[model samples]
Target: MYENTVPFKIHSDYTPTGDQPQAIEGLIEGLNAGMRGQTLLGVTGSGKTFTMANIIEKTQRPTLVIAPNKTLAAQLAAEFKAFFPENAVEFFVSYYDYYQPEAYIASTDTYIEKDCDINDEIDRMRHSATSALLERRDVIVVASVSCIYGLGDPSDYKDLMINLRQGMICSRDAVIRKLIDLQYVRNDFEITRGAFRVKGDTLDIFPPSSEELLTRVTFFGDEIEKITEVHYISGKVMWNRNYAVIFPASHYATTKEKLDRALVTIEEELEERLAELREQGKLIEAYRLEQKTRYDLEMLSETGFVKGIENYSRHLTRRKPGEPPYTLMDFMPDDYLLMIDESHVTVPQIGAMYN
Candidate 1:
């Protein structure tokens, strides 16, 4: 675990007024006394966020603030960033602007395929949040209920991260291969996020977490020679770095070994499902399931992926049936504080999600 040396500092012009001071003091006192939960009931005009900021500054802990929706999450994130200008304030929410979930309607005999359009900018912010949590200490993430949804295992994500340093003995081809394993695409003509281009001994990579800055790694034979940051549009070298860390492009990163094992398990499940349907005298259902499962299996075998891959996530993660999927919470430090904004609505919604 990386220890954060910098303490959380609030950069605010206005001091806590009205009931804010008491609320902040009570929250801090409760936290210091090892209280499990505390509530701050305030009217709409009250400066709840400011009080929370004061408590955060006093506690000096990493924080995760959950909002009921994307709008509120974005608002909270903006406010936190303003409050703690020196700290890392990240926004995390579903990247999709619109989503149509995969569903099977037996009565209507209809199957809806999954469809979604990802917001590239939001995806970058999501990556920024995860990376900050792993690499820094003075971090605050404001997220929607999407935080409860599945994400790649943090351990696997950390394992796939590639750290490069100047003067390291490593092959250019090897580094490119590792990037490919982490789901990065190679595009020499078009430079974009999650893409890399090789120009002779130099590899320019645009990480998913960044929008404007691109990393340039120059290799000397089989050894790393230099690393620098370059502006994406201007192509100007901004600064040189001795080391850089590259995280995976996608959240659902998996190893080839895990994919192979998951394929076998998927096949076994398909067989059992087909058998059960046939025994129940539903031959049509059995045929439908068999064809669908086999098509998905073939796609998985050939391309190492399939549409709606999350359906087989249990197998990919090697989790038991009915076990909860790993979420963003798994990426947080052990002693991090969780603040649920608008808890009156957010708390019940979270309970409904589980039920």
Candidate 2:
């Protein structure tokens, strides 16, 4: 069906008796006009997601739903899942059962280091969400502000993904390189998520973001012989698969070349800002900036990461200041349709959602 002319099918037994009809009509009209952003000023219990689903069906475009909290995200995910049983409905949120972010109380001079335990279920859902988005076009991801947070760039993910076939020329070194690029560490001594170990011709991979499903790669003279999934805890083979792809381990898996280029730009900015500070006689701020940037650069050089790393995202992406950061939305194809549930809330949320 042509997307614009596709009918919005409301599956509910109860019809839009009151104001919902007007709200749905307006949203559909705006979407037909190719509006990039819109909102729905809906009240509580107003079937907001239902209306959004109807709009999505009308357009037949992939959609993303952002919720303010995890509970709301879960609710939205469940609802979308029910509404689109045949389509991909996903959830993306923080993969933490508990988290106390690293912080330092300057006034109290107390440091609160990082503390948290991973939530395996949420981690699985996140992996499922990304996999669904990449594999299918009819996906709807309900997420929290976490969607705006940092993650492995989708391009690296696409690159690192391992493509296997029944009979194809494959190199073990090449496969390992892709894994390492995806942030998996070569650990012959210990096996863990984001780490891989080799035994003769067999390889085992613990995908970073996956809670279950460890992949075992069997090689036949540099050609992929077989691929299987195993239980991470039991080390028991759960299923044998003919072919599959493992995504990158982290959200920031860029090449060293890109990192070096980004650093050069950062240095240029440092020089410019330092010159400005000197001209203004802001010696204190200048010294502070120099010390802070130097420390950050040192950290990046040693570990390829540093605290407050996102402050340098602009340099890495080569985007100008005030430009938008990449989000899940950027990963979607152009033919996808976006349906905003609450015009009053979703519109403002899109602009204000960024850090």
Candidate 3:
């Protein structure tokens, strides 16, 4: 059994009533006894979320509450945040407000390119969720089924983090280059998420995980001097820190070396697939595949990404065939608790996800 170093402190006005205390005790006991799957079996208005919160408090483990839809996920996140005001309560769902995936219809001889419109606020929340998991132990993430989708390797994300400390000797130009490599853009006029601006001796950054706060780093010549958090709108310094850690701007972050290796493997796979298609007398299929792959390869070589880039995630992550892609679950600590809300519906939905 893992020891709980961080205690779960639920800040609420009301205590557990009716069967809630009993239910909480039962759940906690089951969890302590290594019960893998146990249902709460509560009806409407049974204070299910309250009981779960109590259980979390008793268990003292980071928890993930998966809701069936975005609406429910938002509601759960709000409730959890209210319960654990001082702890980390984050919401995570698909950032895309609208997404039409790429499609190819052989019978109709038609192809449709992928299109998506991302919600900036939701993207920020997703980043906050991931960052909280990595930085804290008292975290509760309320999420939708999008949690099962592909995310960058947790190790790679940690490896790419930039740590800035006061008195550390570092060049300003080097810092800017590192941020650029992590997908942060330089915008002097507009301060926004994933963007940074540089003045004579100070660098202002709007980190992806933050919504209204900006990080100000003052450099003295080639050495770091100070780091401060400032209000973006009011331009008031909230606090000062000697050090800070900045994560990548995007979830798909990778190193240049990985990209180079992936490009080579992609080419080899394309050639091997083309040869098989030709041997099977599928000339038209082979020609179409060759043309599309070559175009994507050219785009990737030029820009480091192509349309439908996620299709090559396996190669980029260097995973073998049939290996499951890393998901949000991978970001959680090993002893974290996973609570599937409305399991009657959620269970089938999770099962159907693979199909």
Residue 143 local lDDT, model 2: 80
- Lowest lDDT sum, 10 consecutive residues, model 2, at 1-10
Each model's lDDT comes to 0.89, 0.72, 0.87
TM-score for candidate 1, please give it: 0.93
Q: Candidate 3 has which clashing residue pairs, if any?
A: none
Off-target runs (Cα >4 Å) in candidate 1 are 1-5, 104-111, 299-303
Tell me the tens digit of each residue's lDDT in model 1 across 1-355: 4543478999989999887887888888899899989999998868999888888888888899999999999999999999998889999998998899877777677777789898999999999999889988889999998899888788878888999999999999999999988888899998999999999999999999997999999999999999999998899999999989999887777788987998999999888888899999878778777878889889777756677777788888889889999899999999999999999999998899867
- Residue 53, candidate 1: Cα error in Å is 0.9
Task: List the candidates' TM-scores in order.
Answer: 0.93, 0.75, 0.92
Which model, 1 or 2, shows the larger lDDT? 1
Q: Where in model 2 is the C-alpha error above 4 Å?
A: 1-48, 54-58, 94-124, 149-153, 188-191, 274-303, 349-355
TM-score of 3: 0.92
lDDT, candidate 3, 1-355, per-residue tens: 1121356788888999988888888888898899998899888888899899988888779999999999999999999888888788999999998999977776666766789998999999999988878877888999998899998788778788898999999989999988977878899988899989999999998999998999999999999999999998798999899888889987777788887888899999999999999999877778778888899988777656676777888888899989999999999999999999999898788889956
Per-residue lDDT value at 105 in model 2: 57
lDDT of 2 by residue, 8-116 (tens): 3435665665777788789889877978767676668888777778778777777778776778788888888777776778788888787777655545545565677
* Candidate rank order under lDDT: 1, 3, 2
